[model samples]
Target: MDNEGRESGHLMLITPERVFYAGLLGRPHQRCSGAFHVYVAIKGGLRLAAEGAVEGYSELAVVPPNLRHTIASDYRSVICVLIEPETVCVGALDLLAKRLAGAERQFFVGRIHAACEQLQHEPRDGDIFSSAFDIMCFGDALPRRILDARVVKAIAQIGRFSGDPVTAASCAAEAGLSSSRFLHLFKQETGISFRSFRAWKRARHLLHFANQDLNLAHLAQHIGYPDSTHFSHSIRRFYGLKPRAIFSGSRDLAIYRSGRAAAGDSAWTQEAG
Candidate 1:
C-alpha cells in the first residue's frame, strides 16, 4: 500500500453509476448487490463464492448484479468496485470480467491499486463521475446503455429520492403509460423489474449516510423505508450486514459523492466523523 492510502485509511468514491470503495471487508456473508462488483485484493488474495459458480481464490474477482455471494481476504481491508447495471451494457461488463480473468487481470489489479492511492490524495472537492471512474480503473469509459426517453425520465425520478415515496404507478402516470405497460417497458429497458430497481436504489442510498452519526429510525425514514423493521430487513438482505455494522465499520472512512451521486442529489463531499 502507498503512504497516501495508509494515511487516508478508508475511502469511498460514489457516483450515480459507479462506486470505488477501499475499506473494511466486514464479515464475509452472502451479499446480493445490484451492481457489477469487482474485488481486488491488496496484499494476498480474495476467496469468493457466487451463486451457480465454483468457489475460487484469486487476487481479483467479479460478481454480476443480483447474485448472492461472499468474499473474504487475508487482510481486513480491500478495494471494491461497483458498476450500476442500468448504466452500462451487461454483456460488455461480462466481457470485461472475462478479459480481466485473462492476462489483463494483473494489469487491472495494478491500475486499481494505483488509482486507490491517487484518489486518496486527490482534492476533497474534486468532482468525480462514472466516466472518470471507468477511466481511472480501465483506461477508458465503458459503453453506456441507452434507454427510451420515457424510461430515462422515469429513472431520473426514481433516482432522485425524496420524502415522497416512489412507485411504479406514479412513474407510469408520469410517463403517460398504464402501470402494466410501464412495468413491462422498464424491465425491457433495464433488464430488471421496477420493484427490484427501486428497492435496490433505496438500499444503495444507505451508502451516502454510512459514516453519519444518526438514529437508525430517523435514517430509515430519510431513506423512505416504511419502518425501521423493514429497513433493517432490507438492508441485511441486500448487504449481508446490519445497518449498524455498516456505519460502525465506516466510522473513520471518507465518503466522496460525485456531482451525480447515486441518489441523484446535488454534488458534494464529506469526511466521516
Candidate 2:
C-alpha cells in the first residue's frame, strides 16, 4: 500500500516485540504511500498484483513501496509494527524483520506479532519508546541460528549484490535448486518470492539514504536503481511523496493525529545508513 492516501500513525513499543491489528480492502481510487515496510497476512488466503501479474501469498508478503499492488482476503490480518528508522539502530532488527517476513502466511509463530499488539495497547509512549531504543542501539545483526542457514545464505547473496545477473535463476543456482523449485520452497519457508524480497530490500536501502546529502541520481545508484526517475517511482509507490519531502523532514505532511506528536511533536529521523 502507498502512504499517499493512507494516514501514517505513530506508536511507541517498549518490549522486544509488539503486534497491531491491520486491515486491507479495495477502493475505487488508487492508493499511494503505505508503510515504509509492509507485511501482509490474509484470512483464508492472500492475493496480490504487481506489475501485470497476479499471485497468492499464502503466508504473508513483505512489500515495500509502490509497485502497483493490492490484497484480497477473507481472513483477519494483524499488521506488525515497523520500528521507527529514526529512533533505533537497525543492525539485527533488520535481520529479524526479514526473518519474520518469511514466516507462514498464518505467520503466527513468534513473539514479534505478540509484541506488536502489546505496544498498541500500552498507555504511555515513553516507556515503550525508551525500551525499543535500547534494543535498536545495542542489538546484534541477525544470527544464523534463527532460520535455515540456506535461507540466510540466499538473503545474504541478494543483499550484497544486484543488477540483471542477480536473477532468481542465479540465486536458485547458488542454493543448488532449479528456479521453479526455488520459488516454491522459498515461498513455503519465507512467504515471498526472491524478486519481491529484493525489491523490498532495495526500497529500504533507498529510505536509509533519503535523508542523506546526496542527489537523487547518485542515491539511485547507491540503492541499485538504474536511474533517478525509476528511483522516484519506487519510493512514490509506498510513500506517495517525493524524496525531497522525506529528506526535509516535511512536517507539513508529517503524520500526526490531531496536531499531536506523542513523542513531543519531534519527527527527526536519525541517519540509519
- Per-prediction TM-score to the true structure, in the order listed: 0.91, 0.43
What is the lDDT of every predicted structure here?
0.84, 0.44
Number of the top-ranking candidate, with lDDT as the measure: 1
lDDT of 2 at 93: 47
Q: Please identify model 1 stretches exceeding 4 Å from their true place.
A: 1-8, 261-273
Question: Candidate 1 on 124-241: residue-level lDDT in tens?
Answer: 4666766667888988788777677777777778877885898899988987889999999889889999999989999998998887789999989988999999999999988889
The C-alpha RMSD in Å for every predicted model, in order, reads 6.2, 13.3
Q: Which 10 successive residues of model 2 have the least lDDT summed? A: 252-261
